[model samples]
Target chain A: MIQIEQISKSYNAHAALKQASFKVDRGELFGLIGPDGAGKTTLIRILMTLLLPDSGKAHIGQWDVVKDYRKIRQHVGYMPGNFSLYRDLTVEENLRFFASVFGTNIKTHYHLIKPIYEQIEPFKNRRAEKLSGGMKQKLALSCSLIHRPELLLLDEPTTGVDAVSRQEFWQMLGTMKEHGITVLVSTPYMEEADLCDRVALIQNGEILEVASPKNIVDHFSSHLYRIKGKERLGLINALRSLSLFTKVYPFGEYIHCTSDEAVEPVVISQQLGQLGMDEIVIEAALPGIEDRFIELMA
Target chain B: MDSIIIDQLTKKFGSFTAVDKVSLRIQKGEIFGLLGANGAGKTTLIKILTGLSGASSGKATVAGFDIHRHVEKVKMNIGYMSQKFSLYEDLTVRENIQLFGGIYGVSSDYIKTKTTLVLDQLGLQDSAKKLVKSLPLGWRQKLAFSVAIFHEPKIVFLDEPTSGVDPITRRQFWEMIYAAASQGITVLVTTHYMDEASYCDRIAIMNAGKMEALGSPGELKAAYQVDHIEDVFIHIVR
Candidate 1:
């Protein structure tokens, strides 16, 4: 469980966090969704008691983030945005070192890290720096779990990782939740928003919306459509020029267009046809997390 | 026009073969994407093509110059931008642009005109006198991209150009790439995001130093019987 109240932090002239407040329930997987300089890292660091917030109070369980910094440090596990593992040490040595820091041994927390550690066991003797990005992530997860902390804080864990590895990393987090560990993850990828129990969409040092991903999408007020045409850029330009469309964005293979009023698919198809576009396909679609984020941003 | 052609290109480091006899071709004005898991040899292949690393065997040609025989020519004809953006944080934005233009051996007059054009295009003219470290990450990334292609190189290699940016910024970044491709400049990009792969004209998926799959996003999806490129990637890499 985690709680924060009116937390605000500023570095010189720039305010990193402004009146930001959110809570995470026990065993809940909470996500902090934001861009690079949107204060996700600053908030995470404040909650971890590594940096002191200029104002407000935060508590992990009953311990205050400031007053109980020492206790909180032992009770929480943190994986920094940048890999902080000892590069010169072997995988097993790194794990052992983290375990020893918490006044425990690897065998003591073997059951806690078994699922993730087993994947990297064969390369236990390899130097941490030599491991692949995915492998290093797994090893970091393993080390973080070696202490059996009740709370886990992951800062953009899947930012530079591949899709399959990103999926696997999230899967590992899901398994951790099953083990009754509470997780707070920050990521720039909007697709990962759906995986969290709840997400706080932060931007420019302010929390815009905090809700479940489904709830966020449900709150999207516009009728959305997906339009595919032979000329991708031309389609975007055409759709943007239309008054019927409130927002037009190129999403993957199709251009996602939003309307203020409900519009028929046939009408859109006819309009594109009149515009000399070929192979036009228009269909009603449900909004996704990215769509909702863009709307919230606007 | 074939901007890049390769055949049986192999790059080995000591006992490990990083790139194992890979072959592919990229057309001019094409938005070619290289998709692969980390350590899948995508970086190795790009280095070999860009003349940063020597291939252990086989041959390749980039920008109408042999990679091995005419390394300088190949280097001169291509621009590279990685995730780090490779900008000098200590220098002002104008100074950074000038330094890159000088390195590419562009004339002083051309650098002056091009600098003004690039700053205007990116809307960073107001920040030209400020240090690169003072600007936001998004602005820095766009500036890095501008500097990379300032010389109007035949091919531009983008290595994860939109890694940490939000979805909105990523969309805007792709638009710039599209503009470059429209100008008949070949764009070869490597990305971990499958959603971005769909934006490319063609994509090649690499796995364990081998080309596991290569085709347009539509063709690859049809071949894999999947609706999304992520699923197609999983199907091939798994």
Candidate 2:
């Protein structure tokens, strides 16, 4: 439903997007995965026609982003990275206002936002500014869906939200996908990439890789290892000091270590033991999207 | 030594309790992690501890000063950095360091030395004169953290400091945290990232205004019979 071709945008000497190109298939849940200032927002804004790109072309369905900006606005719902709803307006009022802005009524599209809106419906009379962070996010999502656009563009919708809320937000998006609404969402969290049918990894305004999550992980050529023990920092430093491992970094309860050649867990255990680092747990591990992203970035 | 001590701390808004008699002690030079969902009262608790807001009941001490009886002393002894609250976007990096140093009452000479050290550590020597708004999010976060602890406060508070930052930068930020703790500065942090729980010396999980779990990551895992901290959190907060 969306096609972007060599789109680039720059401000002064810094390039926000350097010849970026990607596509979102019809009814596909595509993710733009990157950290802050990776041009995810710039790409989304260009597609929304809120900001004009310096070069290249983009289209939503049959209309060009520049030539038919008005037509595109009617078909895509955008929730910006920052909350953009009327702060003083009541939750219900915000939804109603957005519905009218698109020449539609809430009743006509109530089903589109019902799953998410109902979670905050009890506070429909509350002002947008008074709601908590999660509630405000749900309200903004409700407003965006109240218009029932064919496509949804979410910019870091789960960036600062907690895990539970982030999970629920993805579930809401899943429902949207089931209804044949195409989604193009951006997020800094690498774990969220698993939820998308396909994702484009971006960094410093450049696309690093594009593939399904499984495909991305499958391409991780090295055998990974999970190491955990006391003196977490010491363990990381010790592993880094060794020339045997290609990557050694802290990951949750354990350290994710990788090497260019196959290495046994017993070898790592013995090496650390000889260094006076005892009680270490070493095991073979599978690579996740985060591991793959870090490798690609490196 | 205990850097922070709390006894039956409680905060209320009208009839709703935002913090319910939460009590915990943190040792000096320790990385303590606070984990919670939204509306779980993590912010409320942090506010009470940071002296930005008061508790309706209970008692607490931060940085060896009573939070209620010595608000100014408490504020002076503690540092705070969050994704949304730190730094002046329009100001240049050097200007921000100077401004914060002045606010913290650090000696100008110390500020000068530390500023150079910080810029060197983050590889921002060339961009020190550039506006903070122009820096990438990772650099901004690193700079903000340095400014927070520049005064060498007894304790530092980081609220989701790595949120929205790249994975590599996030790990780099933790290295700084480890360095600070090694210097005998206590660190209290709140985050939504579950993996970060393992980085802490100890972690407390808050749910609905109450601390549902508190222990080291290994202990929590053993207690909950789970392999990952995220599983332990989900089990407690579900």
Candidate 3:
């Protein structure tokens, strides 16, 4: 369980966090969704007691982040944005080192890391540097859990990883949540936002909206339409030139067009036909977190 | 016209075979995408094509030059931008562009005119005099891409050029790629983002040094009975 109140941090002229406030329920999987330089890392560092906030307060289960830094470090597990493992050491050695640093042994927390560790146990003797990106991340997660911390903080864990590996890593985090460990993960991928129980969309050092993924999508106050045509570029240009549409963006094979009020699909089709677009298909659609985030930012 | 041709291309490092008997062709001005998990041989294959690594067996030709006998010629006809952007952080944006232009043997007078055009196109004219480190990640990526193709190479290779960028910026970057492709510049890109594969004219999914699937995004999704490219990727890789 973590609580943050009116936290504000700045470095020289740039303010990284401004009156940012949020809370994570006990055993909840919370996500910080935003782009780089959006203060996700700064906030996480503040909670880890690695950086002091300029103002306000934060607590991790009754222990103040400032005064009880040592205790908080002992009770928290952090995996930074970049993989931070002893490259020269073997996988097993790195795990042991982290366990020893926390005043514990691997055996003491074997059950806690069994699910994640077992995946990489076969390569225990291999050096960390030789492992693949996915393997290295799994090793990092294993080391973080070697101490059986109550809270886990992951910063952009799946940023550069492949789709399958990203799915597996999220599945691992889901298991950790079931084990009663409070999880807070940050990511730039908007699709992953739905996986968290609740997410805080932060941008430019401010919290835009904090809600469940479904609730966030439900709050989108505009009607969305998915439009597909043979000429992708022409379709985009035509849709953007339309005066009725508020926003038009390319989404995979189709363009997602939004309007301030409900509009008939036939009206859009007629406009595209006049623009010489071919094979036009228009259908009503639901907006996702990414669309909602863009709307809020706008 | 074919920009690239390969026959049973294979690369081995020690006892490990990084690329195993791979064969594919990229048409002129086509946007080709490579999707694979880490260590799945995507990098090894790209290195071989770009003349950064040697192939242990088989034959390949890039831009009409045999990769085995004419590696330098292959390099001359191709441009590459890695995930890291390959820009000097300490150098100002204009200085970095000038450095790359000089390396590519472009005339100084032409570099001046091209530099201004590129900056204006990316809307980075205001930041042209600033150090690359001071610019945002998205701007740096766009600049890196522009520099990679500054020499007007026949083919451009981009390796995860949109990694870590915001969604909006990533879309804008793709528009740049589209603009280049329309100008008859062939593109061979590798990315981990499955959603991006849809934008490519055609894509190949590699697994364990083997080409597992190859088709347009719609065709691949149809083959796998999925609605999205992400599902197609998961279905193939899993």
Candidate 4:
């Protein structure tokens, strides 16, 4: 249960957030998806009361962000994008310190973060700085949840961690949600846009679109075809020159081309063959979240 | 030509070996990506090549200069943007450029032209006088990148330059990298994002202080028979 209304923030001339508004339902794994400088962090800061907004208001349940910062801080687990843990402190020490700050002991909420803590428990004596990026992430998440807050706010928590660790971190977040803790995570990866229950695509501090990942891609009004040929560069050049294609993005070994009008696979293969292409495979395909984001951005 | 060459490179910090026998080659005019989870020795390897840290027992040459010797020449020939936005937060955008330029012994006249060029490229011409703390994260990241390579070093080392920027900004940042490569500037970048590794000309994946795989993204993906770099990485590291 979070509500943000018309939040605006700016740093000198660069506008970070321009009256952005959104809401997160209780127990929802909500995602604030955007590129950098999209005001996702600013919103998180405003909600956490770490930074005050120039205008607008935000609330966590009944308390306001600006007026009840202390109360909100106690109730919201926050993992900042930056490495905020004391570099010199050991993993266990940092967890204990954060737990004490929230007037709770690590053991009191140890089970809440056991899945993550177990990964770093062996290195409990290791300093925060000495741990790997993935270890630091787990330690940070563990500390943040030591108080068993009602909400969790993670700002690109997996940005610099490995893919497997990123997956593990999301799994931990899901466990938190099982306990009825509302989780709000922000990420820059377009493919990660679907991990949450719902995502709000943001850009330049404005909400572009908010919908389920599948819904977003399904709503795309263009027909897409996955095509590939022996002459990669030549095929790419020829396909771009064709006016029928709306978008031609190279996806691994194949080219995902979106067309203004639905065309037969034979037509695509014939055109590529005419471009002196051989072994060309053309088939109708589904668009991904990143594809949908590109289309939205376009 | 290979802009960088590493032969059985290894770096140890006391009892812990940070980069263990890592060897790789990066070609000129190519955008080479380094992939690793955190603490996988990506940054340590970069530091060793940059001469920021001495390799424990390895031979490496960057831009044709040996890492063990010619440290100053290595620093002069390479422009580095660290993972953190290491710009002076208290200084104005232009002042940061001026300070860095002065440290590098750039002429006042060249600094003036370069500052304007970089600011305009980052769409921050109007905010040149604004303090670094007053800039948005995305703008600041672009500016940091511009500042790192302002002197036009032969090869640029970017350590997770797009950690937090949104997808659109990341795309735009890649365009800038392409532009740099077009000018024959070799790029050595480290990132955790697998998708980003796909966009690179060649990518080397590392795990547990050793290189897991290295090749053009296409080749690696094809060899692993995967649709994305993420799956390829999973196949190798697992």
In the range A95-154, model 1's lDDT, one tens digit per residue, is 999999999999987987898889999999999999989999999999888888999999
Interface RMSD of 4: 3.3
* Tens digits of lDDT, candidate 4, B1-238: 9999999999888898889898888888888999987777888888888888888897998998988889889988888886575699999999999988887778999999998888877888889889998887767777887887788888999987776675556655765776787787899988887876766778999887999898988789789998788988777667
Q: Give each model a TM-score.
A: 0.95, 0.93, 0.95, 0.81
Residue range A1-298, candidate 2, lDDT tens digits:
9998899999899999998888889999999998888899999999999999999999999889999999889989999999889999999999999999989988997877888888999999999999988898999998888778899999999877777777778888888877899999999888888899999999988998889989999999888999988777788898888777998888776789999899988888888888899999999999998888889889
The candidate maximizing TM-score is: 1
lDDT of 1 by residue, B1-238 (tens): 8999999999889999899999898999999999998888999999999998999999899999999899999999999998775799999999999999999999999999999999999998899999999998888888888888999999999988887776677777877887788888999999878877888889999999999999989899999999889999998888
DockQ of 2: 0.62
lDDT of each: 0.90, 0.90, 0.90, 0.84
- Give me the displacement of residue B24 in model 4, in angstroms: 2.7
Worst 10 residues of 1 chain A by lDDT: A228-237
- Model 3, A153-252: lDDT tens per residue? 9989998988988999999999986679999999988889989999999988999999999999999999999987766666788899988799888777
- For residue A141, what is the lDDT in candidate 3? 94
Winner of 1 and 2 under TM-score: 1
Docking class of 3: medium
- Writing each residue's lDDT as its tens digit, candidate 4 over A218-297 gives 87878998886655446666888777688776654466789878989888777766867778888999988877777787
Residue ranges of candidate 4 with Cα displaced over 4 Å: A9-15, A49-57, A62-74, A83-109, A125-130, A223-259, A263-285, B68-76, B83-153, B234-238
Q: Which wins on lDDT, candidate 3 or candidate 4?
A: 3
Q: Which stretches of candidate 3 lie over 4 Å from their true place?
A: none
